[model samples]
Target: MPHKLSEIISWPEQREKAKTYFDSYGWPDNRNEAWKYTSLAHLKEGKFTASSDSAPIDSAQVIDSAAQLEGFYVEISGSAVQLPPQDALPNGISITDITADDNARAAAFTHLADNHLLPALSAMHQTSAIAIDIEKTDSAAPLPAVILNLTGSNKEGACYPFVIVRVHKGAEARIAEIHSSHAGLSCPLMVYEVADDAKLQHIRLQAEASYTTHLGLNQMQMGKNSQINSFAISMGGALSRLETHSLFLGSDAELAQSAIYLGRDRQHHDITSFVAHEIRDCASRQLIRGVLDDKARGVFQGKVRVAPDAQKTDGQQMSRALLLSRDAEADAKPELEIFADDVVCSHGATVGELDENLMFYLKSRGIAEEDARNMLIDAFLVDTLDEIEDPDFAAFMTSQINRWSLARR
Candidate 1:
C-alpha cells in the first residue's frame, strides 16, 4: 500500500509533530471527564497502525449509497476535495476540503483552533480543511444548503481526517456533514466560524460500519450579532464520540444546540459540549436525548460558562435518556460555571425508561406492544428535531431519525 498522503505539500515538516502529539498523551482512560462514559482501551489495545494512502474514491458511488440529502454535495477523501467555482456556486452552498489562504479563512481557522481541538487534528491527519463564505442578505431566501462526504478504506490501518468551515458576514446557510468509512478506524475533526451578523444552521450525522471506530470534534465561533443553530444524530459505529465548543464574541448573539443518539448491541456513543457566554445580552440553549438497548451505552456532558460582565445572559440546558434494557447504560453531567450574578442560567439531566402508562394507553388503542413502544420512542425524540428553523432541514432530520428507529426495531 502507498505509505503517505500524496497530496500534502507540507508533510515532511508536520510528520514529527504528529507522532509527538499522539505519543506524548496516553489514550484516554476512564477517569477523564470528557471520556468517563466511553473507553478507548479497545482502540488503543488493538495495535492499529496509521492509515496508508489509498486510491481515489468515487463521489457518485458514495452519494448513491448514502441516505438522500437535499443540498449541494461535496466529498472529502484524504487531503483531496472537489468544489464548484464561486460564481457557479449553487443557491444551496457546498464545498469540500478547503483551506484558509486569505483573511476571511484565517478568521474562522484561528477561532476554531483557539477554542477547540482542531490544532491536534490539523497536526495529525492528511485530510482537507474546508472553508465556507456566506454572503449577507436582508430577506430570508431558501436556506442555502451544504453537504460534506467523508469516505475511506482502513483495511490496512487507522486514519485521521479533518474538515473546516467558515460562514461569512451577513450570509445565511444550512449545512449537513456525514461521516462514512468501510474498513478502518477513522478519527475526523471539523471546525466552523460564524461571522458578525450572519446566520448558520448545521446538521451532523454519523453512520459508519459496525467494525469502525470513530472520534469527532466540532468547534464553532459565533461573531457579534450572529446566530447559530445546530443539531447532530449518531446511529452507527462500534464507538463514536462528538465534542462541541462554541464562544460568543459579539453581543446579542444566539446559539442553540440539540442531539439524538441511538445505540444497539455493544455500540457506544458520547456527546460533550461547552458553550461560553462572554458578552452582554447573549443567549444559548441546549437539549440532548438518547435511546440505548441491548448492551449499548450513551453519554452526555454539557457545560455553560458566563463571564462576569455578561449580564442579562440567558442560558438553559437539559439532557434526557431512555434505557431500554437492563444491561444498557446512560450517563449525563450538566454543569454551569458562572461569574455573573445578574445572569439567568439553569441545567438539568434525566435518565429513565419508557412510561408504562403511556405504553398501556397506546396498547389500549389496539396498537401492538412492540409498535406502541416504538411510537413512544419516536415521540420522545421529535422535540429535538423540531428545533430546526427551516422546514426542509427538519424533513431531512426526521428521515434520519426514522431510518435509525426502524433498524433498531
Candidate 2:
C-alpha cells in the first residue's frame, strides 16, 4: 500500500487540490450530518501502511471461485491480477488498467476530484485502477456480465482500489463487484457512466472478515433515457460504511436501487445514499433493509434532491430495519429536498422487531423456534430480494441470507 501524501504527489495537480481540500475540512467528525452515525475513531487509531501482500491469498482458490460466477471475471488481490487478455473478451467489452491510458487516467481524476473525503482519499492512495468500457454494437443479444473481485491481505494497512465503468450509447450491460477481505482496512471507489438509451445492472457484495474495517464510495451519472438498477448486499466487517451518490444528467433517465445488510455480534453497518434529479422527467427509487442481532448496530441515511428546474421528477425512498435482539440497535434517516413544484417525491423509514404473533403462529404449525425466527426474517427481506431481475443472483443472495441467519441461531 502507498502512503497518502506520497501517492498524491505522484500526480502534482491533484496533489495540490487534494491538499487544499484536506487542510480546509480534514476528516469528518460526529458533527458532520453525513457522518453523525459513523465514527472514524477506529481508523484513526490504527497504523495503516500500504503493502501488496499476496502471500495470504490462494490464487487457485480465487480462480475457482470466479469460475462459478457468470461473467468475464477480473480478480484484484491487492493489485490487478488474473485479468484476461483483450482478445479473449467479447467484442464490445474491454477491461484494462486505467494507468495504461493517459486519457482514461485524466478522466478518472476529473470524475473523482469533486467527491467527499473517502473518495478523495481513495483517489490519492489508490494502488491500482481498472477501467471497463462497453461500446454499442449492432448485435441484438444482451452483453454478458463483468465481475470484478477485490481481496485484501492480512496486514493491518489500508488498501485502495478504484474502478471506472462506461456504457456506450444504446448498449446494455451487467456488472458485479465482490469485496472479500481479511483483517485490514479497505477503501474502494467506483464511478459509473450510463450513456443515452443504455441500461446497466450493477451489483455489489461486501463480505469481509469480522475483524476488517471497510469504507466505500460509488458515484453514478445517467444520460437521457438511460436506466440503472443497482443491488447491494452487506453481511461482513466489524465496521463498514458504504455511500452512493447518483446524478441524473439528462431528462427521462431512471434509477432503481435496493440494498440488504446483515450484522451480528458487535458489528456495525452503515448504508448512506444521495440521489440528485438535475433534469426534468427523471425518476429514482430506493429501498433499504437491515437485520441486526447480538448487540450489533445498523444505520441507514438516504436523501433525494430535485433541482428547481427539474419539473415532473419522480422520487421515492424507504428504509426498514429488523432487530433480532434486545441489545441490537437500528437508526434510520430518510429525507427529501425538492425544489420543483411539479415533482412527486416521498421518503419514509421504519425500525422494528419481528412480529411475535407471526412467530408464534409459525411455531404452532410445528416449526422449531429457530426455524420460525429464520422464516419470518426471510419473509421480511424477500420482497427486496425479489426486486432483483436476475434469478441466479437473487438465489445467491438468498443463500447468503440463509447462511447468516443459521449462524445467528
lDDT of candidate 2 over 143-191, digit per residue (tens) = 7889888877765666788888999898887888888866388888888
Q: Candidates' TM-scores?
A: 0.86, 0.91
Tell me the deviation in Å of residue 216 in model 2.
0.5
Give the Cα error of residue 99 in candidate 2, in Å: 2.8
RMSD of each: 6.3, 4.9
Q: How would you encode candidate 1's per-residue C-alpha lDDT over 1-409 as one tens digit per residue? A: 0012123334433445445656666476777656777777765676532221212233343356444676666776655576656566755354533443433233334444331223454555545566665666555665557777776666455556566666878778777877766546767776777889888888887776666666777877788888988988877677777878778888999998888888888778888888888788999988899999888889998889888999999999989999999998999988898999999899999999999999999999999999999889999988678788867668877887886777677
Off by over 4 Å in 2: 1-11, 47-66, 100-102, 111-115
Question: Model 2 lDDT vs. the true structure?
Answer: 0.78
Candidate 2 scores a C-alpha RMSD against the true structure in Å of 4.9
| Model 2 / residue 24 / CA error / Å | 3.8
